[model samples]
Target: MSATPSWQAADGCVHTGPLLQSVNGFDVVACEACGFSHTLPLPTPQELEHIYSHEYYTQEKPLYIERYLEDKAWWDEVYAERYERLEAELPAGRRRLLDIGSGPGLFLAAGRERGWNVMGVEPSERASSYSREVLKLDVRSMFLNEETAPTLGQFDVVNLGEVLEHLPDPAGMLRLVHGLLAPGGMLVALVPNDFNPFQRVLNESMGVAPWWVAPPHHLNYFDTDTLPRLVQRCGFEVRHVETTFPIDLFLLMGHNYIGNDTLGRQAHAMRKTLEMNLRAGGETGRALKSRLHRAFAGLGLGREVLAFARKIDDSPSPA
Candidate 1:
């Protein structure tokens, strides 16, 4: 294999290896001028798959599944709010939606109720099986790539909520997804914003890796700066891109300050404290905090992002 040129990260400094995992003797260091993080020697697709498919990610802990199902009922109710905002301009005539990494089929379930033909591609047996059993979703146990690409027909909308960060080559994967879409189809993706304040506090002030910085599992960390470019490279023109992540910060702080051992007795205690913190914050305090967090996010301090786009007539035509 030939060595590739090191990426000059959004941060001005040049980095060469995986920023997330130190296992390959690859590490990330920051740029001085701007604060974008960069990793060394970008990972190959094979390395990325191994890390993602590692037991930690693919494992389906019953506790987590149960907790998410309980808490995510709200998301189920609120999901299409974004698409609804742009429904007038969203793909019309036909809508076949494909959700990559459709954990428990939340989006697909919601989309189905709203009249879109929906399917999901997930590698985890537990998650996909549960989606079929519980949501009655037509999800398949497949990973996105050349082999699976030809099987799924053209879709009207493809949504990848919080799924790109885990991939080895998001741009390449988007190419496959774009190919799966019919002309004028839309692609919506959500990615982590590395510049989120909580992450900044952990990395800059404390000099600790953001616990979210689990390497191998997450090979590509994106923010507003790199996202549009990545999507455009995959052959989609920007439609409407809005980046917001206050809720994610709340979750990240809970995980960091409260706890990480989700399987432990400590997690039980921490989760209670987290609930109390929200309750004490009060109904008004809660909304106020979310507003303030949004202000911070508007200033580009939030930890996650959502981008929406539509297929353009010209795609530089995929090979």
Candidate 2:
């Protein structure tokens, strides 16, 4: 692992304030010059690999994928809408895409299905193999660093889906992504909106970590406000912004087990959680909840958000 960055907070992430007791384990500090409310005590490269290989992500096949693939027509319509929006502003045809941390190669699958030439960079051997063998796509098993980046030409579109916050240094990673873009290339990034309402309520009540809080996996958090700054720091200019993925199952999972006994026990926990969630709110309730969620999301409460930016000109900076 690289030496612990000089910018890391000496006292670590936890600190004291009047309103908030302890802000979990994150090391938050305002930059002396820019006053960015960002996390410090960022993970080292070694820490990053440990967190990613931990039990949290070892399990494959999240329930959402199963549901998404089973309902092909529905997912098609949804992706079409998304594809139109996410790709509309950028130039079409002759577009080569690179998806970092392409687990299970879902986006690559979509790209291939759409006839887009896509390449993936993943560190996990198992996931990379699955992406290649199962999805029949090309994938490279390597971390994104100076040594690992391919000398291949710049890409036209880069996708960083649920990937930036997982890095030890988001600023550095964004700079690297910027270097790999062709002229006028656009970057499509999606991270969990750290300031979402459900997250606020969860942290206020239960001290339990949100699923997105998997230690070491998520070392940084970004919202709409801070995200653009980070992007500009890495040398890309913000072109478009959209908060998406309003139908989040993670919050539903939490609302299911909240205030609930027999949650951590064996025997029917998953089944019971599903039953309780479906019962407290059947699909009808979930549908209405999604509608309400969209309304709140328009007000900035979406669980996930997708931001688009372009490399206006070359202006890469140092760490």
Candidate 3:
């Protein structure tokens, strides 16, 4: 586990708090300097490469692809909302997008179907292969690093969904994305909102173990505040922030899904049902849900956070 007295985060913030919790034998600590939390002894580059390229889909989560296929309709709805939001900010005829860690290339496909120029970079061999062979999407089977970033060219929007938490140096990744973005381009980063009030309530008040803290897979933890701060520090102007449905509310309401697969499925089903029903109600229903979720985001209560930022234009001022 390599437990240490203090650890320096990628953003130059040092974390010195005592161990917050240990999950799967890895120690986690909170960074008072940056209001972030992460695991100790981050994995090496080689280890990360092997894990993602080989073991991630095959060994770590064998049924991920199947489950994703099952929820394809719902996934499309989620992607549509994001695309609509980002497109609203863009001028007419500018819809180039690059999705990092684009698992199975579904997001890219959705964007392309919406008449947007889309590309993806995914490290997982199985997932990337599926994206290419099955989905016929333009997904590169490699990680997004300095060497590869330049070749990808500029993008109007960069999407990083559930990606930063898995990295050892998230700031470095964002910096690369900054360079890849066209002037005034947007960056959409979606990550799980951890260590929030709801999660603390579930862990402390309820008998739920810290189920969200999955080490080796998720090395960094971020809430809405910390995530925006990180993105802004990387030379982006934070535009909008919102959260998805707080699934933990089910647990809070006596539907204990912790450690029970059946209850967990039921809870997820109910949540999806509510969202699907609201979405079926057309524009009014969509607006209502958006307002409700925005309120939840303001309170920092959600299962996941979606932040939209724009690359700060650095053009020289005319004399």
The model with the greatest TM-score is 3
Alpha-carbon shift of residue 269 in model 1 (angstroms): 14
**For each candidate, what is the lDDT?**
0.64, 0.61, 0.86
Candidate 3 residue spans exceeding 4 A from truth: 1-4, 8-14, 33-35, 315-319
Q: Clashes in model 3: which pairs?
A: none
Kindly list the per-residue Cα lDDT of model 2 for residues 1-319, writing each as its tens digit.
Answer: 2222125344353422212111455544433422233445556687667555543335533443444444444334444444565467666665588888886677677777877788998777767777899889888877778767655457888888888767756666777887888888888888877745666666666555554444345555566666767776777888766565433334446544433424422223343344335335766865564365346545666656667788877574645
Q: What is the TM-score of each candidate against the true structure?
A: 0.74, 0.71, 0.93
User: In model 3, how large is the Cα lDDT of residue 285?
Assistant: 95
Give Cα distance to truth, residue 72, candidate 3, Å: 1.1
Clash counts for the predictions, in order: 8, 2, 0
> Can you rank all candidates by lDDT, best first?
3, 1, 2
Superposed Cα deviation of residue 10, candidate 3 (Å): 11
